[model samples]
Target: MPHHPDLATTVRIRLIEPDETDAVAAVTEAAYSHDYELPESYRRSLLDVATRAAHDQVWVAEDPATGRILGTVWTPLPGERISPLARDGELDFRLLAVAPDARGRGIGAALTRHVIALGRERGARRVVMNSGSEMVGAHRLYLALGFVRLTDREGPVEVAPGRFLDLFAFGYDLD
Candidate 1:
């Protein structure tokens, strides 16, 4: 596949640093919770950057001029297992969130492309992720990037007690 055009040149996507934990977490939480009702448990999970950084490769999108964190996404380390949605030869990412204020500037697209590029570098045959069904904006971005909805994987997932979320699976074939 040809390289994706750089969509957000002003935003730099890079791995998260220890000192930037709070910033990343805040951006993620603010983005995720914006205009949506989130269960407290799930909301807290969005703020758990340190845990994700320890287990997966946590990445951040930064505004180069201001040194401000604008978004984040988490993917497994190269050749490691993380999301159950990924099988052998597949790479998966989760928790793609862009700051509410940064919505129309292509920050989310850049971060997603960064994940796909990471997958390509790791010799992955496909890249996949599960997004909340209500996340219509995110779905649009995924589709624009050549991801197709995996209908077979669409179902309700238990997030916390008494709360279930409808999730849509999207995949991009690297072949």
Candidate 2:
């Protein structure tokens, strides 16, 4: 995996340690729950940081001075992709969430910037993520950060048995 033990970000971006799994999971779930009515399975998935960490790398954005986690996001290990939205040479990230209380502090943006850096460092031609249509704020952020909508990848994703969420795809070209 790529290591950035000392990212010089105002909001420190680093791996989510074992002890912080609960905190990060809470932030992620709370952030999403505020906007949507999550099904039991989806809610459980949001709270299961360990499984995400086991599959990819879970990262947290923290208040540098206080060491408090403000947000969380996960990306597949270098040269890997967890979301089908990503094609070869693309790095895909998912579950980006900033604690409701921490919004407007740029924690989300910082985490995204960190992910972009990770993609560039890993020699990816692009970085991609899929977001639900309800996440308007997140869409603005992605666009402001230079991500473009990927119409071809937009579709409905099953969040639970016989249930679905309309997802839109976005990509940041790093080339």
Candidate 3:
């Protein structure tokens, strides 16, 4: 893919450093809130996952000019064999988001590709993400990137009265 100069020229993706944890959490909360009403506790739980070694493999895309985080994706490293769909291996992608003001500049796609590359390098057979069904745009992007719908599961939490989340699990085979 040709890199777009207008989309923050010096953008780079790197492992999340300890100091950027708060910024990562803030961006995740802000980004998700745009599409869904996440409970404070859920947001906090997401943030807390960054602190746990076994569950954390976060990456942040930063703007080189101003040193601001443009987007981030949290991917868990490959672990015990999980399922047939996880045949290649598994890297659970969570909390992927681009800053609101930075949308449409390809940051989200760039981040997704970055994580896929990371998964390949780490010997992951596949990369998976659970996205809300209502996030049509994101689902489209995932499909565009070669991710196939594996299954759908009910979200663990309900954000509205009589309303439950339908989370779609998508996967991309690395090999």
**TM-score, per-candidate, Cα-based:** 0.92, 0.92, 0.80
Misplaced by over 4 Å in model 1 are 1-8
**Clashing residue pairs for model 2:** none
RMSD of each: 2.7, 4.6, 3.9
* Model 2: how far residue 107 lies from native, Å: 0.9
Error of 1 at 67 (Å): 0.7
Candidate 3 global Cα RMSD: 3.9
- Superposition error at 51 for model 1 (Å): 0.5
lDDT of 3 by residue, 125-171 (tens): 88887777788889888898899988643344353565566677888
Better of 1 and 2 by TM-score: 1
Which structure is stronger by lDDT: 1 or 3? 1
Which residue pairs show collisions in model 3? 88-125
Q: What's the ranking of the predictions by TM-score, best on top? A: 1, 2, 3
**Candidate 2 local lDDT, 1-175, one digit each (tens):** 1334444555778898888989988899999998888988989989999988887899998888888888999999887779778899999999999989878777788799999999999999999999989888899999989999999999898867898889999999998
Count clashing residue pairs in model 1: 0
Better of 1 and 3 by TM-score: 1
